[model samples]
Target chain A: MSAPEELTVDVNGFQTRVWRKGSGPVLGFIAGYGGLPRWVPFLDHLAERRTVIVPSLPGFPGGERGHTVLDSHLDWIVAVRTLMEKSGLVGADLAGSSVGASMAAEMAAVWPADVRRLALIAPLGLYDETDPPADPWAQRADDVPGLMCADPEVWKALKAPPEGANSIEWPIEQVRANEAAARIFWPMGNTQLAKRLPRIAAPTLLLWGEHDRVMPRSYAARIGALLGGRHETRVIGGAGHLAELDRPREAADAILSWTS
Target chain B: MKLMWFHLMPYTELPDDFRQRHPSVWVDIHSELFDPKRAHLMYNDFMDELEYAADCGFDAICVNEHHSNGYGLMPSPNLIASSLARRTTNTALCVMGNSLALYNPPTRVAEEFAMIDVISGGRLIAGFPVGTPMDTCYAYGQNPSMLRQRYLEAHDLVMRAWQEKETFAFNGRFNQQRYVNIWPRPIQQPHPPVWVPGGGSVETWRWCAEMEYVYCYLSYYGYKAGRATMDGFWNEMARLGKDRNPYRAGFLQFVGVGESRQHALDLYSEAAEYFYGRCLHVDPKWATPPGYTSEGSQRAGIESQVKQAADSIVRGKSTGERMAATARDMKGIVDNGYVIIGSPDEVAEQLREVAVTLNVGHLMLLLQFGNMNKEVCRFNTKLFADKVKPLLSGLFSEWEDRWWPKPMEDNLRAEIPAFLPKLAAE
Candidate 1:
């Protein structure tokens, strides 16, 4: 019902802002390319029974100001692992979307003992030559909203420029986030996570939206199979890449059923 | 004033429907659009134009680096600079310059520049650019956030390598070398004078000012579009208590010279259209990769102003309204000061105004642009050299240009005759 309180946390050397709420079992959520928008009803729904922690990935809007020199995906996994450990998130449930989803899988594979459950929404790092994912960096700024969401209203709402911010401040914020995303996912998002997908001992949940054109269903299926046993796949209807924002009820129900 | 003839060496023969069918002229544009047969002639002619400019008595001839683009065919400017060093004898070599961060050790840049300096008998004005986002971030797949950091580190390494006489170890964030020695040190003491070419970034203005390096504004939009940027640099220089010597800055402008103003316009209108319409049809997305603008720069709000100004000009709107690049006709280009098309006197007068207004002592002339043929390019270069240059050469004679090449005096500046005269004896 209320907006989550924001907390600034320093992991190792870098710092990031995290949004947290609820009081039950700890759950860590890594943001996607569009980042954690102002509103997310599913975050509230999940917060009903579980404590949720969302850290802004570096280079995005509210993340640490000056740390974008990640040499490889392994460096990113190590950084995220350090953050989780620093945040006291031992054996907790971890969820990620898009670039974040791929990072979550990496954390699960690399530090299995620290993560009990893994949930990926429109996850990346899995490449399908026949059915490849859309490049967020290549798409025109005007075409971004439509490509991101299936619903026209949501698309229109997202495309509208922010109010109160000056012209320079507006694009500056967007470019910062985009720069961070590009650093991690440019050229291609594949970190060869498929090789380590089977190493993820935690129970995995793969969620894909029916209208999610960016990361198609083929990727979800491939990730599901690569993850081997103790994994489940759920396809949500009438939603795009951001199922939690589009069909929050359906997304919440799936997460609740699995975690409960 | 010091005059340098700069060439983008554009792939001039793009299909008429290139803008309509292609998403961009850079980065991801299909390679099928490029035909090697056509490129053979273009490259040779481009080189001929640069050589002809040198022969026409231009003080320096310039070349630069770009990648995977139809706009500039010189991915490795050193190759062209090297070839030009052999062909020309007197003119200073302004290799304005190689992309430092792209090299692995970055000593490669130092070594190549040293070789060029040695070959040219010490005539090399080294230009260190952060490079455009499309070149570094997308085409080369460098991380946008770390690119500047990498560039800075590479710069430190390159400068130190060129200056240090003895072998030393360099442990940098981007590169680590056990033996940091480079052979064939530059002829210019403590290395050649460094010139930094940048699009209007506030950070660059500050950096160039602090380093005391010549700050060059290389915008395709020309003198009018560059007013704010040049003003910002001068203001920064004053803030730092640096001298207001006009020699501290260089500005690039498109120039077309003919027998008369009307004839000049008629000669260059199609060429200007080809350049503005097709050569610069870059997708906005490719141009600005996120994090390309640093958080500090973004916060400072300078990048925004530059972007807005550029966008307005592109849209043909009079936002800041000084010079609209979106007014994409020959007349608009001429009127907006994007291109100076006129007779010798008319062109010289406008150039004098530009020099005085911008306070630039080193002026880089883009005389041959777009699809202008070899004959036209040579004619433009010669006319400017013979007519316009002499008038404006005395404008900034008060200040010394420390950024210019210090070529050996003993070596004769061997001049090639413009054309052989027929024998008079019968």
Candidate 2:
């Protein structure tokens, strides 16, 4: 596989960063909470199969930050739809992880024509009060890695700033991503996406991390059941939330087989 | 040089091993630990102490807001301030005050504060604190990232509600209202003087300086630890070209006035221990939630707080140790200036220096703190009013206090307390 192409697009007045590579079919990917600051091995693996397009959710890692004030869930969803359209990923097979996964799944639900096939890895939209998921926002900064990943060291390694990037600005960008997410899903992670799940008509794949502490495997089963059309659950072992970062090869294969 | 009587109103009946058993005094502090019957007594005693302070001739009587905490019992400080408004006629009623973000519509705050001001005949120093992370974020579920934004929006809404004569539609990001028409308009023209109580937030001093509001530094760590925060405020004032009228800034300090140094220690030691050891026994996790402090504040030392807390976990530093709380003893408290304790003359001299050095005019003194009994709190209040206040009132007398509440009558402090503590024994 050749080098991934870095690009930028305007999403509803907000300038967002996008990355594209590989050939075949267009695979529009939305990144997880720990954003794709650098091209992770997972993206490299996924790129081997088909053309992959990943847009930085506004206020996420590479996205323009001063536009952190995305007011509500509707605003966020519309912004995601714009990202899909602007990145030329309309009608493409779509995938996302964690909060990104939630946005991807919502795109299929609310704007069904935007996403042809859906792959959501540990999506964080549906919140169960009886068996609540761990609040990623509430965790201590140092402890967050251990909470989200099977091995904390994997997260530390993934967070290394790409070459030619400001080492100081890298951490600041990550915090801005969190701040943006917190704006939409604060107090708790519930976006009431369960209400809109039945609207999704696309064939969906719910991939969950076996060791995921943030959103457990139970959430995937619930999400699979809630999705409108045919959907299946696949547990990627030796991983946690945002499984692609932890078990990139395994996560890539699961998505390629199910969605590609 | 206006002296204000402030009370934290800490719960009085935690067991001797409360800190050992409890993870924190805030947020997850067990509900079962609170006994309403005992709180009933504590509440009345605390109220009596404030009234006594008013009678003892403090310029202002103050109460503040906190939630789900063993440290501060006044979740609705407006309720306390409203009650104080009715009971005390002369002293300014300072509600240190409602956390603007926690209230919905923001007009709720404006309406309630107006009621307090009207009831007090315009003696209201409205404190607009963004609130601590434990209170606003955890207890009230205000998002740490948007807490300040919500607070600022609420501030704008509340100010507009007070100043706008006609009902107006408020369209805010966090809060909205179809019509904001507040009844019982504040007796003070436009609104009561705005006092923003801040702790380690860089944006607050800038905001306060821009708004020409009083920036009250309400740090529990006393005057020594308070210098940096106060200096930051003054520097911002100087840079902004705002006059350092002293009243433009307020400072809270734990104070104890006794016959001598030993007597002061004997009087305040247990309460200081209880306050520093138990009242501040916050779990490190609950202390600094992410996005609670801004980037500028993060640089200013909020990061150091989080870093210290993380190190505290590694070093297994107790709450007492984390705060450098002077080892929960009177001597350490004095050494750290966590509490000012000495004879009336000594305390007065030291406090005068604190006022001049920190350049703060509105001195909100914690004469009643921790689990001190009502009698002692009154004794401390009366002693400070009689001795310490007179000495310091002359320090900044040349500068006019523009931020004070212009009351209908400032004659409230003339009345003496029912009884003073017995000083001389046979």
Which sections of candidate 1 miss by over 4 Å? A12-15, A37-39, A69-72, A128-130, A152-171, B300-325, B411-426
Q: Could you report the DockQ of all the candidates, in the order they appear?
A: 0.62, 0.42
Off by over 4 Å in 2: A1-3, A160-167, B299-331, B409-426
> How many residue pairs clash in all the candidates, one count each?
2, 1
Model 2: CAPRI class:
acceptable
Residue B65, candidate 1: C-alpha displacement in angstroms:
1.0
How far in Å is the alpha carbon of B244 misplaced in model 1?
0.9
User: Where's the lowest-lDDT run of ten residues in candidate 2 chain B?
Assistant: B311-320
Score residue A186 of candidate 1 by CA lDDT. 72
